[model samples]
Target: MLAGIGLLAAVTVGLTGCAGSGGSAPAASGGISEAKAKTATSAADFGGMKGLVASANAEGHLNVITLPPTWANYAKIIAGFKKKYPKIAITSANPNGSSADEVAAAKSLKGQSTAPDVFDIGTAVLNQNLGLFAPYKVSNWADIPADFKDPAGKWYYDYTGLMSIGYDSSKVSTPPTSFADLLGPSYKGKVAIKGDPTQANEAASAVYLAALQSGGSADNIQPGIDFFSKLKKAGNFLSVLPTQATVNSGQTPVVLQWSYNNLAFGAAGGSAGNPNWKTVILPGSALGSYYNQAINVDAPHPAAARLWQEYIYTPEVQNLYLAAGAYPATLAAMQKNKTVNEATLKTVGEPPANFVQLTADQATKAGTLLSAKWRAAIAG
Candidate 1:
């Protein structure tokens, strides 16, 4: 999850490290020119879905970055796409990398056959690297809210989850109810943030949520930094980047992460090693954020990349995200049309109305502040 607009704002907004010049072939010697796919703004540009599918089938591959199988049910989503289009093979790299890593990978692999075709990134990173994305709208563009996508189609939100506190019940008799509860001695050396705030959107959102809880707003994140400083000083803030294995092993017993991720871990339960893992969204501390999806400007498999955008935006795929506990970008439309999965709706429910989200500007500013202050404030 990355910095995005709040629900009120229509609830808007990878790791690759390296730099490379993205280049394109002069023309396709065969069918469905790569140059044409690179410049296409919609399926209509390719003569419609049949033409687009044929072009993509000719390309035969899609390279993606920073998509972990376990996160937000990507495994099943990927499988579903494969089932739908067996001709297009999907290759995902650096599944655990941050948004920054995605940018780096784009640069490093530019013009190569293995270069990523699309990106799933945070709004903060998206704003900072706007030049890298190509402008292309999906078939269901109208279904997405105005605030959730760029008018030019450079990027659009894919799915979202609320910020939450996840803890191991057996390890801590008193589960944390709020950010203040984390400062007590019982939680010393137990709490962990997902990743480095300066580089990872999840960690940045965790800070953003803490800011709200500690007398700060979207534009003011210093309080959140100060709150973490206080936690560090009290020996309760652990600097480790947490993962599923860490949570299951009790290494990072208390973690600040997205609700969907925590819920997934809890669902894994004893079978995955941690029997008492639980997730909670603190009252009055609701914070929601969505990750944006974009096509790489110099994607190696241009047609395949565009096809991927078309495939994922379908209501069926959106419903897949819901089953994984993530609220899809087309959620409102799904609900209005009664296309959403009722069972999933009953389980996860809708996003909180009061949750606050940051606009692109707010996220960029907050990210800058974190880059400058986060490390020094929480340094051990």
Candidate 2:
């Protein structure tokens, strides 16, 4: 769910299985042996990036699902990939689908030419479906932190954002400074999360954040559920999913989402977007989470799938994420090597010093609890 940012409109996009082999049977392309390219862990396996690109071009198609154009500057990234490798045809599907939808698509489309070549997903969902991923390290694998990726490269962190409150300034005359403030009558019937917490990472994280603010620790998310139940009871929570159109129209006046998403909304807003949109980080509430990228083990276009992975990890694409207010997974490496855009970094600013990124176990535990309790807790 990573909310795919603001899906503006549906665009289609949509992982799996081993350190070297799962069930992918890539055909020989550009003279590369079928087995060699199919099992390539790194570009060096194909001799280098040049060889990988050639093989991918020969295969000539990438089926990505659930990647919304408005999310994390993906439109430009997709366009850039096309410009860089024109021979590779890209098919993007189900742009606004949730993380669960991504998994479902991969299952239903298994063994087909149109199955998702890659996935951009939440950690919670990815962990639950690990068998679906293929382990393949990118060229810059060493640069990624051990904590952000699986040891076998089944999946790796892509970009991330901290939880924050976004509000239409015109509608919220007195800005809320904390989760507690959101319950005030001034904000009644105005607050919303990104999607169903039981099915979406962003919404789930919002609940986690509420848990932290309402006396629960990372190990216990019950307070978050209790808090939402209270919000609903107070008539301060809106059930509708907020979008660009909703924000601009003043239908969804307040939202709980990632900093990057809200910041993007406000930046593109003020006139053509929201007339007075603003994003705020509530005091002592910096819950951060990163979306992950994984190649489907049963990918129809194996070579192209790996190629796309290599492309996104490049400095150009990483900076594109930063420009859109997201913190790329390679940010630490980029900073050390002085490759990051200084201006963009300054514009994006630093995340709260106390930002809390849940461990894999923590996310799993939370998702399980939500799956069981979220519906009943939020039901009217």
Candidate 3:
């Protein structure tokens, strides 16, 4: 749940494309093959087949639009890409607004004159606007996990964050350990959530976590609603969404947030002396949601977009994200990235010892049921 500056910066920079393999075999999930990786690595020698980078530079520069304004690390990532393709210039335009704003921009890009070369969007937006993407499977596409990419190769997830609970130690001695703990008397009137289930990603995370805790499947979300209803009855649920400032100031003691956001807050204000904050990934819960990147269907600089994507998914960049408390999607990169210290991994809430990946269809169905159930629970 890292918020604002650090989280967005890490996500933006860390979300580069997958790396090319020299001789490594392709993963079953449709990642980059060894041969393609070598070709991409030697992109400068590709001659007339200059790929997206050449095309983008020919157009003067590559244009990118993103939703996360706090993505301060964009410059660093862009700099890295520039080192490889010096001729390609990157122009970034971040329209600060909701997912709806990104969707609007995607639609706007359909027009030849107004189109951007790349886009970064939330999971919901990516799935909803699959049409805006051009499905040119990257050379490293085989390396990416199937669950992380679109079936049609439209969009792919680079990093992920778990929806977790944050607690202010000054306000309470024992933080909630499990989902049931949130319903306890000590936490009554102390909890704050992000959004209504139907409106926000964080709200959807809450539902997903509740469903997991209650043993509900994608088709059954009653457990999630029941969990929320219990909290509502106890008058424990604070309906307002907690912000970075509010959490850092200790104004709201307990918040359901992304692990990255919580970690960022803790890094800023959490210490041994005051020890103001702490975050915990509730057991028996799924990773709440993800943010994704995609190349525009008619990108003016397709090669640049591909290169950018590759850079974002590399071990070095992924580690940068891990440093900021977000989880990288590439297992190889995660294993190779030395910057991802053990402490940071613990804070970011790595997958459980025995984790199960969810299918897109399953996630969609689960989200739908959970939304309905959450509404009923909140109402009741």
Candidate 4:
């Protein structure tokens, strides 16, 4: 549940699922393996690659939701998945949808082909929808920290990024380096957050970072809310969510978002597709957190859903997450194996030494407060 935890992401079977033959196996009743599919909690549950691959390819596609290519270098991850498993077609929906939106999609799209087969969301949202996740443990399950994963293998923490300020160097003469700089007269009508704090994990993290800077702790978030309310009163806060288009057009000259988000936008955003944007650090506040990944419990393509999770934890893919400024969940294991990409580390550097991380209880408490107070605090 820490800030940068981008709660975010394969198999083969030798034979066609029972759905195809219906001889002795009816696709194992919602699973592609000869074993019951719905009861599969991990890749081991499947008999072998022959069944998993064939069953997954038989299902044909993976429906993932809310995976913006810019966030944590997901474009590469998706591309890699397809390359590794050429048969499974991967489809992404709602690139701009939030953690809350993902849970809603899983529940609301229960029996549909469109249900997100996999998810990358914050721990707060993950907690609300635990029962909806199909319990799954990756091949490298031992590599993940105990505290970061669910005991039942339902969901696990994936990566972490810090909250940061993204700026267009050409527009602002003096780029704000501190949280206080955002409230200055020059920033009026120029600064924006990724989304509404009550609904978006990134936006809510921004509020938490502001609280840290505004004489508050995880126990008290009012100060952060007050800081934004002040920005609203000064006309400095624009509700429009920051996007590559918005950033390039100067609509949102400054964006308060995750460091990975800011860096990704800077590297690939703009009219010419260049890294013209810059990310700045605020004094003494690194809102570091990890996001969670889960599989839809009732996913139509259960085999494909499980495959996606396995692929994401691989060393190469985990490194892809790092190249895009995210700290992958298997980082510690990678370091031990001497597979930690030093070059990638230099791009993002070590996270701030002075950082604030909310405990499970603190985050749960904070979520309640944010949901109840965010609207009134920003209203006219």
lDDT of 1 by residue, 1-380 (tens): 22221111111111112222333333433446888889999999888888888888777777878887667767777777777988777787888899999999999988788788899998898899999999999998999999999999999999988898888888998978779999999999999987888888999999999999999999899999999999999999887878778887789999998876776566432244354777778878588788999999999888878888998899898987776668899988988989988766766666777878899999999999999998899887
TM-score of each: 0.91, 0.90, 0.70, 0.89
- Candidate 4 lDDT: 0.76
The 10 consecutive residues of candidate 3 with the worst lDDT sum are: 19-28
Candidate 1 colliding pairs, count: 14
Give per-residue lDDT, candidate 1, residue 46.
85
- Mark the regions of model 1 whose C-alpha exceeds 4 Å error after superposition: 1-31, 268-270
Candidate 1, residue 95: how far the Cα is off, in Å? 0.6
Candidate 2 clash total? 19
- On TM-score, the stronger of 2 and 3 is 2
Q: What is candidate 2's lDDT per residue for 1-380, written digit by digit as tens?
A: 12333331121211110011123335755648756666778888888989898888777788888776667777778888888998777888777678888899999988878788899999899989999999899999987899889999989999997787899989999988778888889999999998999888889999999998999978899999999998998999999998877888888999998776676566443234564777777667478899999998888888889999999999899988877767899998999999998767766665557778888899999999999998898787
* Count of clashes, each model: 14, 19, 25, 29
lDDT of 3 by residue, 25-54 (tens): 122122232234223332343332344344
Q: By TM-score, how accurate is candidate 1?
A: 0.91
Q: lDDT of each prediction vs. the true structure?
A: 0.81, 0.81, 0.58, 0.76
Model 2 alpha-carbon miss at residue 344, Å:
0.9
Candidate 4 lDDT tens digits, 86-174:
86777788888999999888888777777777889887777766788878888889999998788889988888887888888888888
